[model samples]
Structures are given as structure tokens and as C-alpha cells.
Target: MGVIPALVILYFTIKGYEDYFKDKKIFLSFVAGLLAGFFSVLFESFVRNAGVVSLIVLIPFFEQIVKTSILNSRLARGTEGAPIYGATLGLGFGSIFIPFSMVIYASRWSGLDIVGLSIVTLGAIGFIFFHGATGIYIGYGVKSDRVW
Candidate 1:
């Protein structure tokens, strides 16, 4: 991913964290949820063997659910913080994936033309934004009592 994409992701993440800090209890829960969500995959060999599609859907689902629960629970008090919480989760998750993505992209396309590089940059930005949006929606839903 290009620097611009990375920055955008970072911006959202920071925003999410700021929201969570509005309630320290909720914020701590979010941190715990994120860590648990992030590490949950490591202990599950079965999911890995379930194939690529399952792995792709399951891991993110698990993380989002856990985070949403934590963030949403705080909404009964107020929803003012949902956006930040969501953005933070997205940013955190994206940060973890981006470096590896950059390495793989650079290695494979290092010799490609500028057009190829541009494609990679765009893809990265799109992916990060998509992830950020997902977080935002999920958190917002939970906080607003619109959905869970």
C-alpha cells in the first residue's frame, strides 16, 4: 500500500481509539476484544484446515463480533463513541495486515511498470477503506441499537 492509504487507515484507527476512550471501561473491553480477536486465530488449527474461504470469513467475523459486543455494550450509556471505536479496530487490524501485504506486493511486482504499482496502491487503499467501513458500520449498529 502507498503512504496515503496507510495514513488513511491510521486516521480511522486513531479516531476509533478516541471514541473508546470516552469510556475507559468500554475502551479496556475494546482492547481486550481486539487482542482476543487478533490472537484467537493462532490457537485454531481446525479453522486453518477449513480452507481459505472459511478462514477469510471466520477470522474477521470473530474479531468484529467481539469488538462490536464491547463497543456496543457501552452504547446504552451513549453512542457518541462508536465511530472512534470502530475506526480504531479497523486501523489496528489493517496495520497488522499492511506490512505483510506491502512486502508481498513489492516482491512480486517490484519489476512491474508504474501502472502495476499504481494498481497495487489503489488496491491497498480500497482494502483498508473497506475494512474501516466495516468496522464503522458494525460499531455504529451496535451503538445505535439498530442492529447487533
Candidate 2:
């Protein structure tokens, strides 16, 4: 259940990392990924009780806004800025989830075994790709136009 997703997350994150390095925007990448993860979890949790629909619709918009903010903060004006910013934000969202997932797994497994812990870690990695892809799209929009 978990390892498969972990592999997925690893794949996308690695790709994201490559993009970050290729552009030589380490600071932006790290910060964006960190911020994405932080904000996604916060926003997701806050809206979780409200319902999945609300979370799905609202979170993406918020995600895009947050992503654009990061881009606007560091990079100079350019066409690629939006995409680049979005990618970094996606990475951030994915990276942060990894640890939280591990904790969640640990709690689930409590005193019986380590499977829960392992599962969470793997699951978290899977989530990384999901979030990363989202960031890419959101950032792409922000860069393409002043949608935000």
C-alpha cells in the first residue's frame, strides 16, 4: 500500500529536484517546496471537516495563490517564472507531507509493529507526487497570466 506510493513520490520529487537544479534556483526550490507542504497540510486540515468538495475546490486556488506569492518574491520578471515557481511549491508540498505521514503511521502502529510506520513513510512519498503535480499546474497558470 505504501511502498508503491513512496516510489511515485520519489520519482516526481526527484524530477522536481532536477528541475530546481537545472535552473540553479536552490533557494527558491527549497523554500517553495517547504512552503507548499506547510500550507497544503494546514489548509487541508482546516477544511477537512467542512467536506472533501470544499477542500478540493478551495485548496487548489489557495495553492496557486501561495505558489505565485513565492515566485513573485524571489524571481525576476519572466515567462518561465510561473512554471518554475509552481514546480518549487509542488516540491515543498510533497516534501513536508513525508514526515507527517511517518508520524501518522507510527501512531497507527502504536505498540504492535513497525508496519504502520513504514506504511506512513511510503504513503507520504506517494503524496509528494500528487501535490507536486498540483503545484506545477497552479504555478503554470500564475505565470501565464495575472489570474491571481
Candidate 3:
């Protein structure tokens, strides 16, 4: 369900910055982000017993960390394109996050109507941006030699 929107956003966003990257670095970073997203989902599954607070806290913490792992890629080395690549990676992570969370919370799933659905959509968008912004921050940090 969420995959289409995620990919749509990812495609438009990355396409705009494609000129900044060389070879397949941008694509590689996105793939790495997808891997990070899958890894986070699998990792989260094994730790679901930690309770709700952890779901709101620890899981996201770990995820942001993992999503940023793309920053370590050879394609992400240059400062000029780091943030763009980072955002791509982050959006890629967002691509999997919705399906991942839907599965994790399936037992508790409930349909929401207009208002509730709107809120959920907004929240998802915000979180996707959260991933992108954090990626940008870390990527920028690396570019600035802060050693992200």
C-alpha cells in the first residue's frame, strides 16, 4: 500500500539530483538503504517483546542509525552529492518501512476513517522526512569531516 507513494516520491526526488552523482552511486546508495530497511524489519521482529515504548523509541533510533549506514558507501564519499544520496537512501528506507510496520502491527491493525487516515498519512510523510533529514545531517557531517 505505502510502496507506491514511497517509490513515487523517491523517483522524483532522486531524478532531480541525478546529475550530481556519477556511475551508479546513487542507485547503490538507495539499494543499500533498502537493505538497511529490510535488516531493520528483520531485526525488529526478533525484539518485539520489548514493549510499546521501545517501538516508539528504540526501534526508530536503531533504524535511523541503520538507514545512515548508506553514508558509508563509496558512492557517498563526495560532499557535493552526499546529502542528495543520503536523502535517496532515506527515502528508500521509507519504501520498506510501511509494509514492515504493517506486518509488525498486524495483530493490532484497525482501519481509520477520514481524519484518522489523514493523520496517519501525515505522520508517515513526516517520518519519511525524518529519515531524509537525518540522513542529510549525517551525510553533511561526513562531508564536514565530523566523521558521521
Q: Sorted by TM-score, highest first, which candidate order results?
A: 3, 2, 1
Question: Number of clashes in model 2?
Answer: 5
lDDT of 3 at 58: 88
What do the candidate models score in CA lDDT, each in turn? 0.56, 0.60, 0.70
**Candidate 2 wrong stretches, greater than 4 Å:** 1-24, 43-65, 72-77, 109-112, 146-148
Compared with the true structure, model 2 gives a TM-score of 0.62
After TM-score superposition, the amount by which residue 138's alpha carbon in candidate 2 deviates from its true location, in angstroms, is 2.0
Instruction: Give candidate 2's whole-model lDDT.
Output: 0.60
- Pairs clashing within candidate 3: none
Best of the candidates, lDDT: 3
Q: Considering every candidate listed, which one attains the maximal TM-score?
A: 3
TM-score of 3: 0.74
lDDT of 2 at 17: 45
Better of 2 and 3 by lDDT: 3
Question: Can you give the TM-score per candidate against the true fold?
Answer: 0.54, 0.62, 0.74
Candidate 1 per-residue lDDT over residues 10-103, each given as its tens digit: 5546653554455554445345434643464343345767788767888667766665665566543256566666655554444444444455
Ranking of models by lDDT = 3, 2, 1
